[model samples]
Target: MLKKLFLVAAAAALFSGCANVMPTGGGSASDAADVAAAAERLRIAMVDPTRPALSTLVADELSYGHSGGKVDTKESFIADLLDGKSDFVTITITEQTVKVVDARTAIVRHALAADTNDSGKPGKVALKILGVWQKQGGDWKLLARQAVRAS
Candidate 1:
């Protein structure tokens, strides 16, 4: 019985090779476009400061950092955006690049120019932004983001 079990295990291992089990994690053109669309939706949502949109796009474990050396959790980020503390008048992203890392991960980089009315004060910024988007429950959500002042 032991001999038979060993043989069966070996056969199973041989049949279930690494090639059959390893992750094939390349995104198709359509997938890339879809991710881009999600990102666009997120951008529009931020400028609009829509709560549901922000909540939907952002993961619960999000780590959001600003060019001013302040970092915020997902809750705080969304709260500030909704509270008019981070009011955005216009947000324009340029030189955007999206790289799909694996089946569940993607990296996006862009030059962001945002005109804002922060706490009733006008502000404008140019930043080079990097973000990580992860697929969860079949939807891509922002996991982390960092921004640096653009030179």
Candidate 2:
């Protein structure tokens, strides 16, 4: 009974705080829902790169652009997070929208505010982000992202 309860709790945790994206005559529910899941997981994974979810959440060809005009590939992005070059202390995301561009693509937009430590210096940042996510191998993967400073 305890084991069953634990499993149930774990499943709930996995699905919590994420919206189910049912089709609206333009996109697929499963695909949209998976994109939502991916976006959420990416946030968690950024603050804790030890989570294996990072590996699955991002695509091999990801191009992650920062508000400062720097861009990182998937490897560099994960490495920076893991290595403390960009250490996330706290994050709040708002105004998040997922637009399914097609069967295999999605556009995720959000406003993000985060407290971070970069190169051991503490700072705060606010930005509007646009992400391109592609469905590959039956899973949604982040392909490209660009961030613009929110004024």
Candidate 3:
């Protein structure tokens, strides 16, 4: 009887330890909120762009896709913003949703409406954007983004 009791106690302790471990899928509420905040920061940075701010928000291997099928790397994306090649006069994001795929990754979707002055030509755009965010060292960074023209 004593041996059985020891085994039961050992099993209970092991199982309790497992309880503290996060699941491989699904994240906590705070994780979702943090991702949303990171996306908002990126939106703000895009409208009023600064090299340092944009560099911090995007990953080194960022792949940014435009509604017109053009893609930009991390360097090009920042350069265009700073150089007025791709300019955003004002931006508004709506119908935003964030899905935490895991503890370290999230998928965010939103509608982007903006007035732009790209290459000194004024224009407006409405797009549906999908962004992939990855947490690195506690801060979420945009790894990839794709945009399509809104119908």
Model 2 residue runs over 4 Å out of place are 1-26
Question: What TM-scores do the predictions have?
Answer: 0.81, 0.83, 0.82
Q: Write the per-residue lDDT of candidate 3 for residues 18-113, one digit (tens) a residue.
A: 222222367766777677767766776787788988988999999999888899999999999999998999987777777788989988888889
How much lDDT does candidate 2 score? 0.80
lDDT of 2 by residue, 1-151 (tens): 6985575355334543444344444577666766777787787678667536677889999999999989999889988898899999887777777778788888888889999998899999999999999889988899999999999
lDDT of 3 at 31: 77
Q: What local lDDT does model 2 show for residue 56? A: 88
TM-score of 1: 0.81
Candidate 2 vs 3: which has more TM-score: 2
Taken over the whole model, the C-alpha lDDT of each candidate is 0.76, 0.80, 0.81
Write one digit per residue (lDDT tens) for candidate 1, span 1-151.
6985575455434322311122226765444544566677677678777688788889999999999999999999998889989888998877777777677787878888999998899989899999888888978899999999999
Candidate 3 clash pair list: none
Candidate 1 worst ten-residue window by lDDT: 15-24
